[model samples]
Each structure stands twice: as C-alpha cells, then as structure tokens.
Target: MNRIACALAASFLFASAAHAQDWRNHQERAQDRHEVRQDKRELRDDRRDVAELEAVLANFDRARSRGKEREMVAVESQLRQLLKQELVEGRAELAQDHAEIRRDNREVRSEQWDSRHGGDRRDLRDDRQDRRDDIRDARVEAASQSARKNIARELSSLMGSRRPRDLQRTRTLIIDLIQLARKEVRDTKQEAREDRRELREDRREARDNRW
Candidate 1:
C-alpha cells in the first residue's frame, strides 16, 4: 500500500533525525570535556611558570666568579623583566576579576538604594593607615637621632678618659650605648620599611579597585 510506504518513509526520516541529534549531543559533550581539560592544563602551566619565576628571583644574585657574576646580572635582568611582565598580567587579571565582583555588588546595592531613597549612592572608602604609620615613623626617627647623639657623646667622653681601668670601663659603656643606639636605629628603619611596604600594598589595592 502507498499509504503504508509513506508512513514507513516518515518513520525512517524521524529515526535518522534522532540518530543525528544523538551524535551531535555526544560531540558537544566531548567538546565540553576537551575544553575543561585544556583549561586545567593551562592552569597547571601558569603555576609552573610562577614557580620557575620565584626560583630565578631567589638565585639570580648568587654567582661569585667575575664572568659568572656578569652573566648572572644579565640573566637576572631578563628574569626581572619576565617576572615584571607576569606580575603585570596577573595584576590585570585580578583587577578584572575585582571589577566584575564590584560591578555585581554595585548592581545589588543599587537596587536596594533605589528602593530606599530613589538615589543610588556607592561608597568608596580610602585607607589612611599609611599616614598614621608615617607619623609614627617620624617619631621613631626623632628618637633614634636623640639616641645616636647620646651614643656619640659617650664615645667622645670615653676617648678623652686617661686612667686605664676608667678608660676600659668608659669604652665598654660607650660600646654598650652605641649598640643600643644602633638597635634603635635599626628599629626605626624597620618601622619605616614596614610603613613603606604597607603604603605600597594600599596603593596596589587602590589601583586594582579602580577598575
């Protein structure tokens, strides 16, 4: 019967379409798995690159031979440039991630702000701990200077003394005072360094936040 043949043909066409759809779904699934594997591979490669960079930075300055030192310097310069580029790229990625997070948060907050007061306001807070640290550093610097002056005076007095025992005692006292002054100076220097580090970190955070 022609009707039976037509029905059979329609069923065959439908079956072919189903088979093609199944094949396409399988291909899509395989493609998704391949993409995931590739992402993992890239992530591992990036981690290895970072480790290599750190090793180069750690050992780049250790060569002692004249020729080797020059070589080391050249290598270190190149490594530094490479690391700088990597760091810049990493920073840009992090900043982009931060910007995306901020944008999402802003959208959430905007809805709430609009509901509350019809004016959407975003708050941006500036960190001033660095300024406070700078003030503390100035005070420590002044104290270190005073201690250095006292140490100098003690050393001068020690140099002028005549009696052997007195001289030895003066010398010992001067040495102790000098050590104390040096310690104070070192402490002040460390505080200043820490403050500078904190300021740099804050600036970096600010830059990252800007986007």
Candidate 2:
C-alpha cells in the first residue's frame, strides 16, 4: 500500500507541474494577443492624426496663397496645436530611444563577455538583432526631432511678421513631418504584423508540445 501511495503521489505531482506549465504558456499567448490588439489600435490612431494634419496643412496652404492674414493665423494656430502633441511625444520617445540604446549596448557587451568565457552562443544572434533595433529606433527619433525643430523655428518666425519666407518655410516643414508620420504608420503596421506572427508561432509550438 505504501508503494502504491508513493506512485500515486508522484503521478499527481507530475500532473500538477504539467498543468502549471500549460497555464503559463496560455498566459504568454494571451499577452501576445493583447499586444497585437494594442498595436492595431495605435496604428489606427496614428493614421487618423496624420489625416487630420494633412487637412490642416492644406488649409494653411490655401491661406498662404491668398495672403489672408486672419485665415493664416487661424490655420497656424490649428497646426501649432496639432504639432505640439507630436513634439511632446517625440521628446519622451527620444528619451526612450536613448535609454534603449544604452540598454542594448550593455546587453551586447555582456553577451560578448560571456561568449569569450565559453557561455551559450545561441543568444548572440538575438542580442545583435536587439542592438540593430535600438539603433533604428534612435534614427527614427532623430528624424522626429529634426521635424520638431523645423516647426518651432518656422512658427517663431511666422509669429513675428508672417513674412513670405515664414510661409515658405512651413511648406517644407509640413511635408517632412507628413513623410515621418507615414513612416511611423508603416513601422507600426509592421510591428503589429510581427506580433501576430509571433503569437501564431507560439500557439503552434504549444500545440506541438502537447502531442
């Protein structure tokens, strides 16, 4: 009877472990799904904001062409308010990009040190990819900062005299910002795609493991 009870206990313990692992995997898959949904929502919001910005740009262009000072003031006010949000967000994003780059550098260095000391080599490729991603993020943030500066400088001039040069400056700034917005949309869409793909792969792996 003692032997039989020991056997039953081991079996119960094994089953409990398996149940816990399965629960953990389910949680991982659910988290991935949540991330995919969040990315999609962000993409939709960005597209909407970009469309609104383009409409405001068009209104500004019309005002500039007509030399309508009052119309220009109204349009510029709208554009400034719209762009203020971007600049604020861009500042925070730039900080995050810098932080990521620093963290990636540290990870890359640690991986190199481990490799030299005969650590697992499988993680090296992933670390390199992370480093590359960090650099790309920094580049995007730099472009956004450039756009922010262009808007600030031109808007300052526009506030002073509404010179033809000030009006001319906005044409270039708005175009650059629009291009950046479109790039963000593309990047966000790709991120969402990758999240979905990862979730699919995880589900498939879990299914295979069960068999």
Candidate 3:
C-alpha cells in the first residue's frame, strides 16, 4: 500500500514538472510573435519614408530643368530640409530597429536554451519540490510498511486461538488494500507518461514556429 502511494506521488511530481516547462515555452513563443510583428511594422514605415524623400528630390529636379531660378531655390531649400530631417529620422529609426532585432535574437536564444535545458528558474523550483516530495513519500511508505508488518505479526500470533473466519477476514482486508494501492499507482504512472509525451510534442512545435 505504501509503495503504491509513493508511486502515485512520483507520477504527480513528474506531471507538474512537464506542465511548468510547457507553460514557459508557450510564453516565450508569444513574445517572439509580438517582436516579429513590431519588426515588420517598422520596416513598412521606413519604406514609406524613403518613398517620400524620392518624390521630393524629383520635384526639385523638375523645377531646375524649367529654368525657374526662384522656384528652383525654394524647391532646393525644401529638398534640403526634407533630406536632413529624413536622414535624422531614418538613422534613429534604423538604430531602433537594429536594437529591437538584437533584443529579439537574444530572446530567441534564451528560449532555445530553455527548451534544451528544461526551462529557467521554474524548473529549478519544480526540481526542489520533487525532491521534497520524494523524501516525504519515502518516509510515509516506510512508516506504512512498518505498521502493516506489526499488524500482520499480531494477527499471526492470534491465528491459532482466533476464529478461522476472523483470521480470513483480516487477510482479505490486507489483500484488498494492496490491490487498491497498486491500481492507483498504475493509473498515476499512465497519466504522467501521457503528460510527458504531450510536453515533448509542444516543445517541438514551438521550435518549428520560431524558425
């Protein structure tokens, strides 16, 4: 009975560990998606700025070709201002995009690291909890086994003097407890295995999406 309880506890711990890792991966992927969207938006804006600068330069050239000196001077001034402003804004936007890209790259690397290493501080926390559960389950199992042994010993001592029916009933009860414990342990183990499998598949999907 005690062994069964210990097995069930171990199964639960395993499931929890897998779940924590899966959740971390999900969050990392979400962040990656947001970064990608922002990068695309910035690129679109940069393209629009470049198009406007080209149009302004074209107008300045047409004014010069028409021999309109005053108009050409005005257009040239406007062109210079537009060029300077665009250059400044473009450089700033480009710098921001570069920085954002670098940040995104770092985030991807961190996510990959977690996928390979079983995920950040959460895994550490889960490991600690598993260790504590192991110790507690072990102690409980030991105590349960000891108590069962003591009960069996007392029953054996009274076996000759006690009614046959009473002895048989006590034996049956112990057997039933053992069976129940085994079933519970088996079910828990099956559930843990399923959870682990799902976690593996999820990690794979996340990796593919990132690439």
Candidate 4:
C-alpha cells in the first residue's frame, strides 16, 4: 500500500511538472507574438518617418528661396526628431532580429553537437538563411507598401486640401517670372544708358566742328 501511494505521488508530481512546463511554453509563445506585433508597428512607424522626411525635403527646397526662415527652421527641427525616432526604432528592430538569430544559432549548434544521425547540416544552415531572407523581404515589402500608402495620402491631401507642394510649385513659378521681369527691366535701363552716352558724344562732336 505504501509503495503504491509513493508511486501515485511520484506520478502526480511528474504531471504537475509537465503542466508547469506546458504553461511556460505557452507564455513564451505569447510573449514572442507580442514582440512580433510591436516590431511590425515599429516598422510601420519607421516607414512613415522616412516618408515624412522626403516630404520635408521637398518642402525645404521650396521654402529655401522664399525667406520663410522661421517656418523652415521649425520643419527642420521636426525632421531631426523624425530621423532620430527612425534610427532608434531601426536599432530596436535590428536588436530583436539579432537576438533571434543568436538564439537560432545556439539551437543549431546544440542540435549539431548532440545529433547521432546527421542528415544534413547544410540544410539547417540553409533554413536559417531562408528565414533571414524572408525577414529582409518582409521589411522591404513593408517599406514599399508604406511608401505607396504615403503617396496615396499625399495625393488625397493635394486633392482635398491646400498642399505645400502645390504652393511651392506656384511660388517657384512666380519667382521665376518675377526674375525674368527684373532682367528685362535691367536690360532696358542699360539700353537707355547707352543711348544717353551716344547722344552726349554726338553733341560733343558737333560742338568741336562748329569751333
């Protein structure tokens, strides 16, 4: 009876341990899923940051000649913040991926060391490479999709509201026209000056002939 009781207790303890391990695995998986979601959000934000930078560059170019120094300074400040945010987010994502890669490498090393039947070590390496390639592709796809979305948003903005890009273009055309007018006025002034100088010379020659 005692032996049977002891055996039962042992079985109960083993079951409890198994349950605990299963719970831990579940929690780990949940955490991993959460991290992946956060990473994706960060990636999206990073893409937006890049798009904003491009827009800022376009605006900066337009404002450069307009003497809108205060507005330009504010925009530049915002651009710097966005750049920093992007860099920080990128570093975070890279760190997450690097940690994942390190974990995979450790697992592969352990598997290689403990394996009695080695099928193909190269296959494992290839799988790791494939995962890396997939991650890179995902990042690129995210950026591309974000860029398209930005373009759509900008187009909508232009159609729906007064866009700075359009304003800048208009301003540039006006400035160019103004410059051309100034050049024409300056040319006319030079012509008048030359005519005046020739008239004076002709009067001087006539006076000398009379003398």
Candidate 5:
C-alpha cells in the first residue's frame, strides 16, 4: 500500500509539471502572434510615411517649376526637417524592436532553463515576466498609434495647399510611391510569415518534449 501511494503521488507531480509546461508554451505562442501583428502594423505605417514623403517631394518640385522661390524654399526646409525627424524616429524604433526581440529570446531561454530545473519558483518568475510583457506591449501599441496620427496630420496639411498643376504631379508621385509601398509590404508580409512558421515549429518541438 505504501509503495502504491508513492507511485500515485509521483504520477500526479509529473502530470502537474507537464500541464505547467504546456501553459508556458501557449503563452509564448501568443506572444509570437502579438509580435507578428505588431510587425504588420509597423509595415503599414512605413508605407504611409513613404507615400507622404513622396507627396511632399512632388509639391516641392511643382513649386520650383512654377518659379515660386519662396514657396520652394519653404517646402525644401520642411522636407529637410521631415527627413531628419523620420531618420531619428526610424533608428529609435529599430533599436526598440531589436531590444524587444532580445528580451523575448531571453524569456524563452529562461523558461527552458526553468523547465529543466523544475520548481514552483519558476511559476512566480513567469508571472512577473508576463506582467512586464503586458506593459511593454501596451507602450508599443500607444507609440504606434501616435506615429500613425502624426503621419496623417502631416499628410493632410501638405495636401491642403494643393494647386491644379500640383494634382497631376502628385498623382504621378503617388503611383510611384504606391508601387514601392506595395513591394515593401509584400516583403514584410513574407518575412512575418516566415517568422510565424519558425515559431510554430518551435512550439511543436516544445510540445513533443513535454510529452
């Protein structure tokens, strides 16, 4: 009877550990999905920025052609400022993305380590990590929305001063920008798809190990 009771308790413990590991894997998969969505949003924003920049460039060209020296100079200044600001923002965002990826990777490694080491303490660590991830995700979403709003406002302001001649030039520029944006969007989507595939494979491997 004593030996039987010990075996039952051991089985229960094993099942509990397996359940915990499964839950951890599910959370990681969800996080990966969130990241893929975030990348898609960023790709859309990038396309918008490209379109706006093209519009501004078109307007500048039109102004120059019309011999409107003052307007040309003003537009040129705006273009320079916009480019500089965009460069700064782009670099900052790239850095943030890299950091987030690194952090996620660390979390994955830690989870694997804990699974190997096996203890209740790992659960507490996971809970803390989840909270941190939630906060970071919220901040990233807010920043993305803010960026989209700013880009829309700038595009609206630039479009407000459009002259009849500017329309044709703007149309041409828009076509070019659209083509470029479409290609970029396609590339981004492909990359995201590949990322998701790898994630799925990792999850499968994790599940196999759990069993």
Candidate 6:
C-alpha cells in the first residue's frame, strides 16, 4: 500500500506540473493576443500618417513645379522642424520595437515548447494556424519597425542638409515607407479575418469536445 501511495503521489506531481505549464502557455497566448491588437491600432495610425504625409509631399511637389517659391519655403521649414521632432520620436519607437521583438520571439519559442505537450494536432488546425499566424505577424512587425527607422533616418539626413539630391532620396524613402505601411495594413486586415474564422471554428470544436 505504501508503494502504491508513493506512485500515486508521483503521478499527481507530474500532472500538476503539466497543468502549470499549460496554464503559463494560456497566459502567454493571451498576452500575444493583446500585443497583436495593440499593433493593429498602431498600424491604423501609421496608415493615416502615411496618407497625410503623402498629400503634403504631393502639394510641395505641385508648388515647386509652379515655382511658388514662397509656399515652398514655408513647406520646407515645416518639414525640417517635423523631421527634427521625428528623429527623437523615431529613436524611442525603435527602442520599443526592439523590446517588443524580443518579447514576441520569446513567446513564439514558448509556443513551440508548448506544442510538444499538446494533444491530437489533427483536430487542432485552428490552434496550429493561430500559432503560425503569431510567428508570421512577429516577422512582419519586425520588418515594419525596421522600415520606420530607415524612414526616420532619411528624414533626419534631409533635415540636416536639404540639397536637391538629399531631397530626392527623402522622397524615395517616403514613398517606400508609405508602401510598407499599406502592406502592413492589408496584412493585418487579412489576419483579422483569419482570427475571426478561427474563433468560430474554435468555438465549434470546444462544443464538440464538451461531449
């Protein structure tokens, strides 16, 4: 009887450890979800910024073409000041991205660890897809952050020396950043659709499992 009791206690300890690990995974998944939402919100704001900046640049181009010297001066001055401020903000944003990327990567690694202990993958397609999405989104966000930093760098260079060639390069960077932001927006929207579909499927699966 004592031998049996020892074995039972050992089993109980193993089960409890498994449960705790699963609970930690659950919390990590929740945190990932919250981060994704936050990223979506930031992307929306970036979309707006891209649009407004594009319009402003377009107006500057039009004014330059028409030889509106006075108007061009005003725009350039404003642009210079804006870029100066952007450099500071961009540095902070890059630091934030660095931290977030590390956190995201850690979560992905944790999820991979959890997968080893997960049950019956055949019925968990949604779960698998969600994990894949998490990984993909992290990569996308990392690229987006890098692009933003590059854009800020270009802006900073132009601000320091607004020569014709520098201006052209800044223009190129602006266009590239705009494209990147748009792509991110589209990707996020696609992910959101997948999330909703997966949620519905997950609900159905949960209900079925309850039986």
TM-score of 2: 0.68
By TM-score, is 3 or 5 better?
5
Tens digits of lDDT, candidate 6, 49-164: 66766775786677657767677667667666544444454455456546654654554455455556664354344455556665666666666667666776667657444467
Per-residue C-alpha lDDT of model 4 across residues 89-146, encoded as one tens digit per residue: 5455456556655654654554354333432354345435534643553454345334
lDDT of 3 by residue, 1-211 (tens): 9999999999997677566556656864564455445445544554554455455446545654575667655654554464355445444534544554454455445555565655544433433433343344334444444444454455445433334465455445434334433432443343334334434544665565355
Prediction RMSDs, each to the true structure: 22.0, 6.5, 38.6, 32.7, 9.6, 5.0
Q: Which stretch of 10 consecutive residues in model 5 shows the poorest summed lDDT? A: 170-179
- Name the candidate, 1 or 5, with the larger TM-score value: 5
Q: Regarding lDDT, does 3 or 4 come out ahead? A: 3
List residue ranges in candidate 2 displaced over 4 A.
Answer: 1-20, 88-150, 153-157
Ten consecutive residues with minimal summed lDDT in candidate 6?
Answer: 119-128
Specify the poorest-scoring 10-residue window by lDDT in model 1.
118-127
> Which scores greater on TM-score, model 1 or model 2?
2
**Where is model 6 more than 4 Å wrong at Cα?**
77-173, 190-211
Error of 2 at 42 (Å): 1.3
Instruction: Give me the overall lDDT of model 3.
Output: 0.49
Residue 174's lDDT within candidate 1 is 37
With candidate 2 superimposed using the best TM-score fit, by how many Å does residue 127's alpha carbon deviate from the native?
10
Backbone clashes for every candidate come to 0, 0, 0, 0, 0, 0
TM-score of model 3 (CA atoms) = 0.39
Ordered from best to worst TM-score, the candidate numbers read 2, 6, 5, 4, 3, 1
Model 4: which ten-residue window has the lowest total lDDT?
153-162
Give lDDT per model, in order: 0.45, 0.71, 0.49, 0.48, 0.60, 0.61
Model 5 superposed RMSD (Cα): 9.6
In model 1, what is the error at residue 187, expressed in angstroms? 2.1
* Tens-place lDDT digits, model 1, residues 1-211: 9999999999997677555434533443453354345435534545555455445434433432233646555544554454344444444434433443443354344335433542212211211333344345445545544554554455445443345564456435434443543454455345435534543543443344344
Q: After superposition, how far is residue 112 of candidate 2 from its true place, in Å?
A: 16
